[model samples]
Target: MNILVLKMGGSILAKLPTSFYQTIVALKQQKICEPIIVHGGGPEINETLKELHVESKFVDGLRVTTNEVLDVAEMVMSGSINKKIVANIQKQGGTAIGMSGVDGKTLQAIPIDNASTLGYVGQVKKVNVSWIEQIMEHGAIPVISPIGIDGSGERLNINGDMAAAAVAKALKAKLALISDIPGVMENVSGKEFVHEQLTKEEIEEKIASGVIYGGMIPKVRSALNGLSGGIKESVILNGLAPEDIKDYIQGKQAGTKVVMKKEEKQHV
Candidate 1:
């Protein structure tokens, strides 16, 4: 039951300096039970689409996916990003296993209805997280790729944040999102930080006011969902600073907290 689900976006993955092998090597020394990673390949997907002469469009902040786009998504996400992280962990003397959300029926989903044409994009409908425990039991890290399957056995491109949330809830874990920015900020500029803990509703208010929009919205919403669904707590932290991981894990305060329910908002 001592597990932390860490979700890192492709932005962070692509930004890893020199290589992430050393970081993973360092992390091996810091044993805090099991850590599972779920990752997205956003920038890589966009770049690949451009190379293939595919135009990109968004409907209400969600990507407008077509069958062609879905192929590219799977290639970049499950093929490139997923394998890369697994290799990094392996080179660091850690046992690493890469899997798409489809592997072993680990993740199942339904459509996200943002638009009728957003083909192949899905909202997480279920997560079978026994793989996480099984991997850790064998001394390996489960490095999840954000690709899922539906009831009809069709593939889906699940959002990494939602994917992580669902997996954390399934595993009954503490969710930690690793991002480029420092956690959620009340002010539009991340410079004005909200260092204290916050509630789901308060975070939603920030999203509505435009203080946090764009990508942060999905990340924040995932954190809230994780807590509401029985995961212990969820945090958004600067993955660039891996040293802070210990502090956040013990709830000593390092990132923006979104696990608190709406009723607890007044207390903060």
Candidate 2:
């Protein structure tokens, strides 16, 4: 069975419309093995934090998770978003269970200061796939919230992209990031600018050449990390499009295919 780990970007999650659910329903008709959904709740998290009168900060895209902010993140991610995603899956005729990175110590972590300024955020140190596999084996999807446990047993909020990559690496699945736009654009000047396909090396070169910058840098970087982390392949794909999952699973070119040294088409 082929496992597919999907990371839903936070930018789209707060407003992930019914169309996204429809696409998951479509995947139900495919040959996909276990499809684990790892989701982000950035906008929602910020919104909730604001309502609670908490100020949020970030360094290198990771939220500065002080204890107060950590409380809110855990509530929003574990209690709110995870359930929402699982409910959507069930409504679409697929069974899914909402869980946290801490469930059965599924994802163990360590503090990631990436730079001296960042605080409390975690980088995945380990992932225990048993719980995830147990759920998947029962024909149930696991909706994972990126909240992990640190070295000292403290709970930490990890970045969704990094969390998804770690989970993909643990399962050695085909990882996919579902986003609002088409994949990485190459031509830049036209509508079809997005790469039909590209090797991770080619992608790095584009970033170095300043062709891909800003928001896209992280998106591509996350995809590359997933590929290098142990997944057979990974993608940056259009999340809102109808049946996007089915399209990519069938290699229909709906978004950018982040290659593994070479195209999967040439694989043995």
Candidate 3:
């Protein structure tokens, strides 16, 4: 079965309409692709940290996970946010099981930097794809939290986009970086529009020109990483539209498809 890895951004999780969940169900029922979700919970974690008077910071688009911050991140991501996504899918009549990367050692990790600078932040060293395959075989979507485990059994914070890229590479699945926006946008003559397709060079140029800045930079970079890892294609698309997923499955252009080079065509 072909797999499609959907990377859900935390900023837009709560705002996602029921139509988005319906798309997941439709995909499964039609056997278009077996969908697996890896989600983020950044805004929620930051809110909780603020409530508890804990200082939070970021370095190079990754949250600086101090021990105190790690505790709250685990709670927000693996505990609350994980189950919330599962429940939302269930409410829309889709089967979903939520689990953290630490569960069954699905994601093994090593620190990205010394703990003195960024406490407990790690990159994925290994991914045990069996856990996801089992769920997929059972006709259920595995909604994964990006909290990884290190060698010493310590919980490590992972960037959700990075986690999704790693999982897609492991499964050799296509990737979609789902967010609230329609796609990569450009202000042409003061009117903004989604750029239906983009190559790595175009993405870099846009970033340098200030057209693609902030959160979108990390997303496109993650997409580039997935492409380099041999995933057929990666996309940045909105989850808000009712017909977006259907369009994608039908080979209709629905969002900004990322390619490694301009000469490359869109691949499955």
Candidate 4:
């Protein structure tokens, strides 16, 4: 089966129209591809922390996860945000199962900094794809939260993009990183146009030339990392554009396809 891992950032989740979920359901129902959702809850987690009067800190874009912060993060990501996405899919007539990486040891991880500077932040050391496959066998889409478990049985906060990339690599699936914008855009003679496809070397050259800057640099880098880790391909897609989802599935032009090499074609 053609498997597509969709990574949605929390910032855009709330703003995504109901049509987004419907498109996903339609794709699965049509057997276009097996779609798995891995999501983040950054904005919601920040809101929850603020409401609870907990101090949130960040170092180099990673949240400095203390025990207290980890608790809130898990509560928001695994508890609320995870179910919301599942419910949205169900409402669109799709079978969906919501879970955290801690469930079934799906994402076995180790602390990124040995629990010193980054505290409970972890990087995925291993991915158990069996459980995810089992869920898929039941005709349900798996909606995963980024909270992971360490070998010592400690729950660790994982970067959502990193977690999603790990799952894509494990499944050997194509990854679709849903973003607010259409895709990576560059200015040519004062006109901006999205690059339909990019390679690792091109992406780096664009970054160095300031064509890819600010927030997009990290996103493209994440896509490059997924490509390097054995994912067939990764694309930056617009969550707001539901039609793009179908376009991507049908092997039609839609978003910016990021590949390891210039001549690499999408397996799906």
Clash totals, every prediction: 0, 1, 0, 0
In candidate 3, which residue ranges exceed 4 Å CA deviation?
189-192, 228-232, 263-268
Could you give candidate 1's per-residue lDDT for residues 1-268 as a string of tens digits? 5677888888788666433445444454467547888898888999999999998788766788888898999999889888989887877677888999889888888887763778779978888767767877777888998788889998888878878888887877778878766787665444576545677778877788887888888778867766765776788877777655667765576888775753343554
Give model 4 RMSD, 1 decimal.
Answer: 2.2
Worst 10 residues of 3 by lDDT: 259-268
Give the per-residue Cα lDDT of candidate 4 at 192: 86
Model 2 is weakest, by summed lDDT over 10 consecutive residues, at 25-34
In order, candidate lDDTs are 0.77, 0.81, 0.87, 0.91
TM-score of 1: 0.84
* TM-score (C-alpha) between model 4 and the true structure: 0.94
lDDT of 3: 0.87
Candidate 2 lDDT over residue span 176-222, tens digit each = 88877878876644645777777877887889999889888888888
User: Best TM-score goes to which candidate?
Assistant: 4
